[model samples]
Target: MNRPRSTCLAVALVATILFQPGARAQVTGAQVRDAIADAVRHLKARQQPDGSWRSRDRYEHGYTCLATLALLLAGEAPTSPPMARALNVIAHAPDEYTYVVSLKIMALAQADPEKYKEDIERSARWLMRAQDESGLWSYQLNPVNYDHSNSQFALLGLNAAAQAGVKVPAGVWQAARRRVLTTQNSDGGWSYTFRGSSYGSMTAAGVSDLLILGGAVVSPVERGVRNGVAPGCGRYREDKPLLNGLRWLGREFSAIQNPGHGRSNLHYWLYAVERCGILSGLQMLGRHDWYREGAAKLVSDQRADGGWGTIENTCFSIMFLAKGRKPLLVQKLQWSADDDWNPDRNDLEHLLDRIGDKLGEPMSWQSVPFDAPLERWLAAPLLYMQGHKFPEWTPNQREKVRQYVEQGGTLFLEACCGREDFRNGAEAFLAETFPLTPLHELDSGHPVYHAYQDVAPAGLMGVDVGCRTSIIYSPFDLSCHWEQANIPLLGERAFDLGLNIAAFATGRRPLRDRLDLVKVAEREDINEPPPPGDPLVLAQVEYHGDWQPDPHALAHFAEYLNEQAGLRVAASARATRLTPEELPRAPFLYMTGHYAFELSGKERAALAAHLRRGGFLFADACCGRREFDASFRAMLRQVAPQGELRRLEPTHPIFSGSPGFRIESVGYRAAALAENPNLSRPELWGLETDGRLAVVYSPYGLGCGLDGHACYNCRGILEADARRMATNVVLYALTR
Candidate 1:
């Protein structure tokens, strides 16, 4: 077989360049999801009356187990009709072959481990009994012919079983780990048996087996690095056989075809690649984004019927997409060239594992370079950086970090080992990156301390960007404790603090992958300048306080108006003061801030005169800050002393659908709902002048939501509702 040299170049190019904003415009998260949905419909249609998807004769049970596992991983509920029927079939099916039994165990364990505990234990024991002295499995027990493929499935089943509370002896994992290490060829790849040429499928299988056996939960030995000797740390390390296998696979990686075996068992190879990537906590292996490249291939290869090929192939494809597409919760940043930035290499993986177990959902994380594109950084809501020393960054990289935070990404800075150098550098970096926003020490009562796990008095400092605290800095070592999961109370505290930060940053919301937020060509129109036909110039009022908390809010709202209301708004909003000269240039004025400031008497008189002249002003307290709220109310009273600022009832025309969809009720952020559980109605106050509502106000935040960013602790309306409300307010300002 002639290996293609271009494959290496393709992977390198994807790694280095394709992560830019609009590089891979054709492939998007939504498109991948739609393809998966289409494949799911195809699978549903292919289900037989017996709930088993038909395959080759006598392999029906194995295929059924595979299909059921795929569907379960694909977000299908166990109570769904097809899944229920499949489960029933799996329960009664005779487990004669090793493959079928392993697959059945996997499916049952995934469906409901507690409920299927007994069945999983039975299958796990069967697998243990079937293991040969060499720690490999074959088609049958005590078989003469053992293969890596069967061993891989057996390990997968046992791992799942172990996760579901079934006890498998440590010796079994040790023996398996030893066998794979010894079997690795000098070329760093694995063959079918111990003699054939190395191929992609077996190499992937080998890598995945090592990952499972050396997993944080399953490894029997201590997790350390020590010359790769006997009884060494079973966890993955730099100089390990696992890395060697990964290197081999990476050298020959191909998403479209199984290397050394063209177009055969392709989906199976892809599935193994997903397992390897996810288990290793790696986003790129030898310059290849295994998930991205493979997902694009599978999506394009999906047939009209949605099946990749045979029943087995389709099952593998589904599993690859479903499990691989799991959103990333955090991206550990590689800030420096050396290991200082990652003293505790597995810190994030261990932290995410604990968080996932606590939340009862799987979470994913990866490490990307600091210079990776803004789009890549935005893949996860949180970007984590830690080091013992100050890491250097270019001007462009510093700007990218700021852009990431501005684009709804949170920056988490930690001083590893409580290093003073790192802490000083972090503070300086924040100061430089956000010169206008100063860091403030978070009190014990801050939500970061209690967002999920209460770790009160946890010393943390933060910087508020836009409507949220976008920068969280810890001037102490937490990753070290996270790496040492066996540390007494310290480990638990570290995990708790880490989980709290994640929850506070993400609001426990479902995250999106990089592809999900890729800028497509169709959205380019939003940034294009509006045609010169009396375009509405949305104006933001500048003031003494932090008036422009969210710089993009007005522009995004303008885009929203253009898209939703067919209004021709200028591409950019104009920032102006409350001078008479500037007030008349735009009829609609938006003002929001996070601090308190009183308008000058002259400016107040100009604003009041503008309102009296039929100009409309919309103001909200950014992030629902009380300071801004109180000051705005006082300013309103001063500006319109005679006109009472009364609450607009649900019966008001604005809520009654005069301008946009009737919003009798709107969704508020979790923080808002926590404060006021019964807050379903729009909370707005209006002041009328000359029998027309000239000024509208909201104590809650609208700017952050209008900017289309996640503000976890913002006591404000949800994004969708905020945009809708802004739409209604804009229409009201224009028409009324």
Candidate 2:
């Protein structure tokens, strides 16, 4: 009643608003992916038949926890077979060691805590009881000897469990933080025992513990880094002890071993370093590539069967190599279109999986409707959109897209089902979105193609899409390809391309930053290497049985790659035969025909050797001919046992970048109508080895389109799209 006496007084009350900070830079997704995949390959190969990975001695709970955590961090879902099995092992096994119990708590916490609510709370309670009066833990719970190593694990598990809604006494955390801070040595690091000489592993552990406590004291050195002041520009600031500990780790950084200690717990120490870096958002430990350099050491040491000598070592290495356990989430927009935008698209998960696999981080996929602010999704590193035709946006909606692009957002647009109307609509929308800037083709030398992998540039023809800043547009039906593929790995090129787009969108550098780095490198070089020269040479295989269906095809491709794609080309495509000697010399080979063909034993051997030595081959049938298909499959089986044809996915890099482009298949239109109606996907198959495509083949005719004069002669990918595909293949071969 008093407030009602003055309406103005009631209106005077205001709410305080806080502006969110800009997105922080993330580690290159590709770097994370490669490391995690390598570590996982090692873990999986060594896992026992019972779903446990065993050390030489026994199947330890700690190993099981670590392995599960590693796989979870590497993007394996909780429901995934390996993760489910590992969890079951931990759930069934008895908990004895404090370390084992703590590790299990942490692993379960990363998974759904509610799903394992009783287990997590029970394990967490055990840890609290196990903690020593000194606010630390030791390997043995009953003896109550406090040690930094055990303390770190106890704190980690507690924090994880607490985050999952388990109650941890506030005093327990406070006491632990105080204990760590008080015990830290003057050098800014810690030791296993109180007041001991500071070492790298212990220091990292100490820093990580304090970070979890959220009471880390900021030093002047750290403030300067965070605020971009003198003494620390372009670096993140951390708490004082953290700064000191990190400084100590940096000073002692070694890829071969953990700093400040011998190699006894090298992998474990490396894992600690990774956690510290991730938590602190530190990109580099001084000047060393902490993730990459560390990965090389671990990968080189991995056994052929894919495990370290011990389960603990394997788990530690896997966790370190996979980075931390944080999961990345990617969202795709759901919008109005001619085709059903929310069609059953189960295959899309594979794309997310590939991205996660490469980055060593798990990815959660979401579908966001357009009703909300676009920024809600754009705030993410990447967003995808696919439909046959886009509905026209209101003026307000258009502004949202504009802001999304201008505010460091990336938009991926694909015209589904190869619908020209959709492609045209997308172009119009783009034009309206950024009228001042015309869409331009990317050059082959663009960093996007080579960010994580060297990608082939699409030759002269406009492929699936073109890019301008944060936007990528394509007319090809990528969803169809993703939906139809059986093997997750087959459509790597499409994924590679998508990754490039995402990388560019999320982490695009300013032109000035690039130039500055270049200048710095030039100034620092002791011996300058000359820049790469021009006049690139590509060799093609001239094999038996009409391999050169369109003799002019090579010349057309050469011209496009040379002039339009920004490469200096030789006069003609270098020709080679299937003989061992010639095959070895042809790094990029093209083989195609409608007739059956045979290879001599020498040729087969040479072909196998060529593939092993990193040669790439592109084969196409002239018009869906069974004869060429049968012969090529037989020959591939002979040349490489691993050369089974797997259908290409839509996310392959071949569909991205300049030399990478997407194409619609003319034959697939008929296939869709005749076979399943839901299968409007053009199919490409690949023979892969050691994670690289050795051969790409199309049973549907690509030769007729390349011939330029025979578009009507075959049921296949259209002429322009065919040219785009050929360009993509040639470029991929040359670079990959």
Top lDDT model: 1
Evaluated at residue 361, the lDDT of candidate 1 is 61
lDDT of the candidates, in the order given:
0.78, 0.61
Q: Write the per-residue lDDT of candidate 1 for residues 1-736, one digit (tens) a residue.
A: 1110001111111232222222332467887788778878888888999798776766658888998998898889998989999999998877677889989999998899888889888888889989999988888888897889999999888888888888888778878877887888888799888878888999999988877765432332334222211122212234356656877876788888999888888999999988887776677766577787888888888888888778788889989988987778888886765555565666776788788745436778877766666667777878998877877677887877887777677899988767778888889888898998899899987878888877867788999887778999988778767665666676688789999998887776666655665331112122244458879988888888798877778877877888888888886787778898878886888999988889999899999999999899998988899999989899989999999889998888778779787998888887788898999888998999989999889989988788877676688888899988888888888776
In terms of TM-score, how similar is model 1 to the real structure? Answer: 0.86
- What TM-score would each prediction reach against the true structure? 0.86, 0.47
Candidate of highest TM-score: 1
- Candidate 2 lDDT over residue span 74-158, tens digit each: 6678887878888888776666667788888878877778898789888888888887777788876675468888888888788
The deviation in Å at residue 526 for candidate 2 is 31
